[model samples]
Target chain A: SQKIEQNSEALNIQEGKTATLTCNYTNYSPAYLQWYRQDPGRGPVFLLLIRENEKEKRKERLKVTFDTTLKQSLFHITASQPADSATYLCAPSRGSARQLTFGSGTQLTVLP
Target chain B: GAGVSQSPSNKVTEKGKDVELRCDPISGHTALYWYRQRLGQGLEFLIYFQGNSAPDKSGLPSDRFSAERTGESVSTLTIQRTQQEDSAVYLCASSVSGDPSNQPQHFGDGTRLSIL
Candidate 1:
């Protein structure tokens, strides 16, 4: 069985600073990883995706890194703002077209 | 029309009752997925639908839970004899296909199920 772990505690950071969240997996080798932002009471919204062969992926101020060797992925929000606060989830999937295994997610709070 | 849509934004049902939640995927998407998010827990994959058939149902928790899709568009997840443990937000997502790389899934607002 495959398992995914993420930072369980909420991350409080000052606005305009960078926030980094980590996602680690065990007993699985996925072909790609995805990041999503989920607001309270709302479903997750896709943010970025990075393949196993890709080292990094960036969209706007969001950046995601995939390290197959470490079995980990890091999601970074640069120039974080209050609006950027949300629960960040990392999903790693194995096959080309299959369901993804998601982590519990890290709640990010950007304080002004 | 633009994004995945789920009905009964909130569902309040009594234990031992049955509940049906609906999901309308994007117009052209061929893959649909159902998930449950319990309080303080991560999203748990319930089932996946490709076209009109479910190829992966490994995440369904029990026999009481079942889902069906038709016309490769609308999907309904039914819970029979629901229990308190079945209380969670039911989310639906769809994508062009479940491509492992670069394909991002769009999610619906979700149906908040509260079993009392």
Candidate 2:
């Protein structure tokens, strides 16, 4: 079966430090991968998306790197702040349609 | 300008009873989806609707779960004889089209359903 795994533990970092999250998947070749930010009791908010052919994508201080060979992706937030604390989710789509299979998110807490 | 909207931000119901959740997609969106999020779990795909094509119901957990969409507009998901395990946040999302390559989904504040 297709499976996606993310860090189950919460990631804590001091203010201005860099926060890195990882997502790994097995038994699937997704065409695109997306990242989302979800706060407690709220739905996920879209963050950034990286395609299979693309090795890396960046938005502001956030960056996403897709390594299809490794079936893994890394999300980074440079200069992280307390406000950046939230659960980050990664979803991958296999076909042209946006039917996504999401992995359990990794919670990041940036202390002030 | 409006995002996807789901009704009854929270619902509490008894087991063995039926419940209906509603979702209003963006005005021009042609694709709608239903998902369930259990506590401490990731989103689980329930169903998908696109234009007038037959819905992809493969994700539904059982016969107790069914959904209906009026064209590209409103969608309703009904759970019959709900079980305690049915408790979860039911989410609705919509994109410009069913072609996943063309658009990203916009989610609404979910309807949290609690079965007692």
| Maximum-DockQ candidate | 1
- Candidate 1 has which clashing residue pairs, if any? A97-B98
Recovered native contacts in candidate 2, as a fraction? 0.53
Backbone clashes, candidate 1: 1
Model 2 Cα lDDT, one tens digit per residue, B1-116:
47888988999999999999999999999888899999989999999888998998989999999999998899999999999999999999888875754357789889999999
Which residue runs does candidate 1 get wrong by more than 4 Å?
Answer: B98-102
Q: Over the full model, what C-alpha lDDT does candidate 2 score relative to the true structure?
A: 0.90
Please write out the lDDT profile of model 1 over residues B1-116, one tens digit for every residue.
88888999999999999999999999999888899999978999999888755458888999999998886789999999999999999999988854634578889989999999
lDDT of 1 by residue, A1-112 (tens): 8889999789999999999999999998988888999999888999888889999988989889999999999998999999998899999888664677789999999999
How many Å off is the CA of A60 in candidate 1?
A: 1.2
Cα-based TM-score, every candidate: 0.96, 0.97
